[model samples]
Target chain A: MLTNEILQQRLTEKFGELVYNFEQPYGMLTFVTDRDNNLKVMNFLKESEDLGFTFLNDLTAVHYPDQLGKELAVVYMLQNIQAGLRIRFKVFTDITHPDVFTATGIFETANWLEREAYDFFGVNFVGHPNLIRIMNVEEMDYHPLRKEYPLEDQTRIDKDDDMFGR
Target chain B: MSQKQNIQLPEGSLGKQTTTLNLGPTHPATHGVFQNILEMDGERIIDAVPTIGFIHRAFEKIAEHRPYYQITPLTDRLNYCSSPINNMGWHMTVEKLIHAELPKRVEYLRVIIMELSRIADHLVCNSVIGVDTGAFTGFIYVFELRELIYEIFEEVCGSRLTTNIGRIGGFERNFSELAFQKINHFLSVFPKAMKEFETLFNRNRIFMERTMGVGGIAAERALNYGFTGPNLRATGIDYDIRTAHPYSGYQDFDFSVPVGTTGDVYDRYLVRNAEIWESISIITQAVKKIKELDPSVFHADIPDFYLPEKADVYTKMEALIYHFKIVMGETAIPAGEVYHSVEGGNGELGFYLISDGGRSPYRLHFRRPCFIYYQAYPEIIKGSMLSDAVVTMSSLNLIAGEIDA
Candidate 1:
């Protein structure tokens, strides 16, 4: 029942410029921010008295290769369980050197999720404790989710020669 | 391409030294082909490492080559237990990219079928948790109900496990009156069957002892792991994607999002049971609402996107041409990216689609609920007894198909 304007005002007062663009689409508030301010903004949101985004609903990445400047974006869907509000935070990163500050300190669940993001999209989470591959094996070089990976050309033939005869 | 490597334990000073055990890829406790190497000190698990990708099929890569319409069948294979929900979610994502509006009746039909699938999915979760705890009878009772639900699916889609029933814009076929009657019959029996399941396990002393306080996590920790759906709700969070963010006219249906005080295995079981009841309530309301509305309301208006009726294709040249175009997946959809998520039985099932103004999506990613929950397994079972690990993993209700996809 909380209005978007009131929520935005409270967030702005609490975290200043960290609260970037606030827009409501499909009846949920989306907050956009730069990679540099992600951890600070998340900490404030978690610890703030008025806004307690206590639950991280979902975390996933979106690739926009053709967009003029930003090539990759990671969207985090956060939920304040007490207030029943869901807000989405998006951090834009350059595909070449995609790195973002980790939120594992604030939310313990991000430990594996950040690893997954790192494995699939090759986005580095700078402060993660163990950022090694979670889904893919350690030696695999390419990030499968990146647009340049060319899904079609990755032969249907078995890549693991040990398991299947060539 | 290296030979299988053996894990070597360090030279030990005494029994207190660390002992390493590889628990899966064939172990009985592992429900699927999941392998976990654990460092243990006697009965306590010290550190656990999970290695997956055993059943990886590279689905996203294959989707890029297929046309928009052909991908529906591929989505069905992601979470094989709840195939219809995945199919509907994929269709909705494509619909969002194209900005196509589905008819009200079609939405209601989707609600009915999807809620039915939710009940089926939760039945497996509850029953499988019982099986993992050495209760075999519970599995049979719940699976019987699941079989009845699958019978309805087989009648409607002509396939049980992988039902590729949805087209791009709407459904491939409207629910026949017979299918509706069967669904009504299933609903009539579902509540009683649920009560029977609860009676069998809800208060059983052994079941409670195994699950009530095992593998618990706080709300804050659960949030950080990006847990969604019932597992997150079990952590006392009242966030349901359906109620928090309504999609497919879910706002019209009246239901409650169950929450628990402790995020334990028992809480997870109770929450899923409550959800089965809520799903039944939603399906009943949807069936009634759909029957009242006109049947034509179930069909979307985009002829180019929707497959032409068989009779129309035979009688009209334009219909034949459109049919050919749809079959070839040559229709040009506007370029855009859309994330469409629905509350799947396990958790939030999301489809993130990127279209490049082409026939096929340039990129497609699935935010699978199982993958997120399974990733948290090591942390949840840390320091607990080895037996509790099986209980915890089953309570998480992970589907290997979804996790690997």
Candidate 2:
């Protein structure tokens, strides 16, 4: 049984100020790291015998247009199957250069997941072997899931934005 | 008939013998709208590259704009074979965010519905594998059972295929007497049908020869690919989400997670078949447990989120106000991040929601399990005979809706 506290303590001790915003929202440990240290933190979590979160449960990105320089938050959900524990970590990068180190080398599941994140949020995954669009057409010019993009078609004149509470 | 003799071949014809075969975006064997570019040498596949996204509807993008309650219908479209599980999973994610305490009856009712849908899903998967392996009788046989399961869902929620069955806290209405009757009838009839279905293929020499050693994946490699549910269980890892992290009172029920050694096409089939039995056992336990609880209790008592009765709305001012608030999507949602996963038909289907104290989620991502399995398809099917690829795919149970979502 690896409790959140023990895992938090180990992460803080090793990474120190490099990791911050340690929160246990809904009893799942969450923290933030510098975009540069994303792979380092993930590698440490996987290789460390005490905190073996070997399973990459999910990988996706959340875009916050209001936050400058930290617009995109690439979230990774990791799980330790034996202990039945899960932890989430975020690495924030700017929209202009949304480059985060890829975890495809560590977990093979990250290959297509990283492609999905890149396809939706335009997050350039550094060092991913084949980071082409997986869910969208290659000819698509813009990422569709960003907050700025409207859900409805722009050219549709019959429906008003006010009706949708936009 | 006249050109019986062999003509002179080009010098490089023997060297470059492999042919490129485009399997589908519409092929009957593919079963879904996804294309596979296979490099084949005669009947054996040398390499495969799958191209997906034919049915991508951008649900994640749409989810960010819709009110939380309205998102249930969108979840229904994913894995349509077992949509009740997806619906319940979405509701549970929101419930986790709001911290709603469900009654025992609601939990047990949910368990029954979810397990029934699991049976429906696995029945489709296993029977389709049989169909691919040249046994069509089992497919026709179990489909009647699937219709029976759908009839039970119709009794509960008035819809069958794209059910959108339950609300955030619990079901829209209490389970009717007919629903329970149908469940009992199916329970009594399903085992015999399933046993017959199994008897047809489980010991047959042809079925065994086709699937026994085909499309095998090591346990370590399956884990590395983030495989879950029966596919991972087929690789001998008993990491079931129901046991690992119990949800919807799954801990109250007694069931077993069946595992296999080789993780091949046959192992996947066996795992799914065994899971159907386990789901039946779970539903049986839930029905028994529900008998001890109050029959009238269905949805939880969360006035803010749950819609009020139409009759009450017409008579009472409080009911009308709550009705208006919920219908207008004006209920307050707290700012937080929550990730909830349910063991879906295929694997661990997760909902990661980030709400900013708004009417809708600020960002919502569905951790679709089929998406993960599809990426591993090319590797799993490589070096296998063309006929074996079809069996491997059906056994994996890849749903294009879930994959491209």
Candidate 3:
């Protein structure tokens, strides 16, 4: 029954500026923060005796190409099963210089998710111990999920240049 | 820790000549184009690096071009075993973006169909796991039930495998009388079939030995890896998207979230079995609830978005106009982003869509359950035997279509 307002106030009182943007839509709480304080906030959420978000339900990324300002956004959905509450955290980064701190220390499940985001969107996770491509080939260069990638090509493919000789 | 130095191995030492084994983009056990390059030390798997993208068809890219209605068929291919749930999830996401309120009768109908699909999906998952562990008979038994379920789907949607049944507002058509009759038949026989499957695998000593503690993962570890649905619940976390966050009027139904003592292959097997029974119970309840509501109440008020009845289209000019608008996707939809999730057979299947006040979504993303679980494949199989790796992967139920999509 605790509203987002009370949760926001409690979070602000505990960590100033670290609370960031708290948006509640459809009775769900979403907090947006800078990459620098991601781990700080995650650890605080996990270890805090009061608000324990013990379960990491989902983790994924969103790329906003048109906005052009915040090109890539990573969202983490966390659930406190005991409290039956879910909260989302979004961290923004520019595509050209996409980098964010890793949450692997805070939650082990994040290791694969961070790698997946890196593989698809080319968002680099600093301090990730094993930051290799999880979905695509190790030799591949382009990130397939980037907004700039062409879905289909109308131009004819030269047989000589075609990798599979199509 | 900051020091960097060259460490050389003694002459003729165990240098970098580890044998590599490609599991598949074509092997039997790899399960649909999932290839893993395993660096081997004799029979022991030293390190395994999974190679995907073989089955990728650029679903997101295609979704960009199509209207919201056209994307439902595309989602059917994501996790093909449970296409109905994927279809429902996509529709719900679009409905959320437009802030459309579905009637209670429609919600009940959706729950019934979704629960039926969940049962079908889990049957296939458990059966496939059995097949991987050298029990072929169990696969046939469950697949028989799957065929019956598919028949019910075909009767309702006019398609068997890739059924894009529901529209944004409601279903494309109400369930036919024959479809309801077939469902009653299936419901009558399904419990006996489920018991047969449980007896064949759950009680078998060989199946137990092959699965029990084979790929044990703790609750904290499973949660960290973002496992949801049955796999997460198998680890004793009583989190079902239906219960934790109710959608489609799931709160009206009474069911229990089954949990396991240890998050092993056996625990997953048990959890799925229990889920199948729970889904059956939910489906029965939903059908009863649907019967109590007025038939007209099973539709949204948004005429422009929903297809007009064939008879109405002929008789009424307004109905014809709405039909045209529905076909062309010219229905008025708001500009917004909404992430709608359902308790998919494998896990939480989420559809996140961004609408730019257009008929077509500006951006659509499928948070596939199999994709997330496959990411943690290597980690779970670590320190497990080479053969156990295959069983572990199978038990995780990583559908390549969903993962690569």
Query: Could you report the DockQ of all the candidates, in the order they appear?
Result: 0.39, 0.85, 0.40
- Record all residue pairs in model 1 with backbone atoms less than 3 Å apart, i.e. clashing: A109-B224, A109-B225, A110-B224
DockQ of 1: 0.39
Q: What is the TM-score of each candidate against the true structure?
A: 0.88, 0.96, 0.90
Candidate 3 — which residues are off by over 4 angstroms?
Answer: A18-21, A66-69, A132-144, A157-166, B1-19, B296-298
Query: For model 3, what is the error of residue B155's alpha carbon versus the real structure, in angstroms, after optimal superposition?
Result: 0.3
Model 1, A1-166: lDDT tens per residue? 5566777887788777867778776456778888898887777777877777876666667777887567888887776765667677789998888888887787766777778788888888898999987767789998887777765445766465645533
Q: After superposition, how far is residue A90 of candidate 3 from its true place, in Å?
A: 2.4
lDDT per residue, candidate 1, B197-304, as tens digits?
A: 899999999999999999998886777677888888999988787886677889999999899879999999999999989989999999888878887555688888
lDDT for model 3: 0.82
Worst 10 residues of 1 chain B by lDDT: B1-10
Could you give the candidate ranking by DockQ, starting with the highest? 2, 3, 1
Question: Candidate 3 residues B130-204, lDDT tens each?
Answer: 998999998998888889989998887888888897887988777877877888898899999889889898879
Best by TM-score: 2
State which candidate has the highest lDDT. Answer: 2
Q: Could you tell me which residue pairs clash in candidate 2? A: none
Q: Rank the candidates by lDDT, best first.
A: 2, 1, 3
| Model 2, position B359: C-alpha lDDT score | 89
